[model samples]
Target: MIFAIETAALQTFDGAFADELFLVARILFGGVIAFIGLNHFLNLEEMAGYAEYKGAPAPTLSVGASGVVLVLGGLAVALGAFPTLAAGALAGFLVVATPMMHDFWAVPEDQRQDELNSFLKNVGLLGMTVLLLAVSTVEWPYAVGVGLV
Candidate 1:
């Protein structure tokens, strides 16, 4: 009886630890994305200028729209509110933004490495967001939300 009780206790602790890890990962991903999205608003003009430089049409409007998407998508993913929609939006954003903004191969050799790094980073973020879309079948313990897979 004593051994059985001890094993149960150990299992409970392990399960709790795993739950905590999931919570932390969700918080971090959401927080970071929100922060980046906020930055877009905070520096709208500068971001627009940069986007314009990169040949984006209606730079100011486009950048603002993108910012809105980021904020909404980031929050949705983070809060586990609408994981599928959020992940899809974010993934789509990355797909377009990565190639359009981080076209390393199209840039001059001197800028190639930097652009490559940026491209890869965006790709990685896209991958994570897409992954969130893949296993979004969770019923969610409550109304609020939970972490990615």
Candidate 2:
């Protein structure tokens, strides 16, 4: 009985630490995503030009709309509000944009490496969003408690 109690106490301590770490992860991860979104606005002309070059219809509008989605979704993830939706939105954006924007195979040889790197990075972000989705249904410790499932 005493051993069991001691084990439980240790588990509680470890769980608290892990929970705090999760919060940190959310902050850093979401912050990067939000910053990327902001960059879309900051470099609007350049980004839109690239999008146009890639044959995106209404390139400027597409970039602006994506920027809004990224900023909102990233902020929600960071704030732990509407976690499932936020993660889902982020995942969806990645799924659509990664392939459309970073078609490394179709790019010229000179640009292929850069595009490949960008593609790989987006893939990594997508994986993280999926991970968040997997956990978003659960109550996150220290969350703002505004989640829908």
Would you estimate the TM-scores of all the predictions?
Answer: 0.81, 0.88
Off by over 4 Å in 2: 1-16
Tens-place lDDT digits, model 1, residues 65-110: 8888888888776677877778888889889988998899899999
Best by TM-score: 2
Worst 10 residues of 2 by lDDT: 4-13
Residues 2-81, candidate 2: write the lDDT tens digits.
55434321222145488889889899899999999999999999999999988888999999989998999888888899
User: Candidate 1 at residue 28, lDDT?
Assistant: 75
Clashing pairs in 2: none
Native-vs-model 2 lDDT? 0.89
Local lDDT at 99 for model 1: 94
Number of clashing residue pairs in every model?
0, 0
Q: What is the lDDT of residue 9 in candidate 1?
A: 17
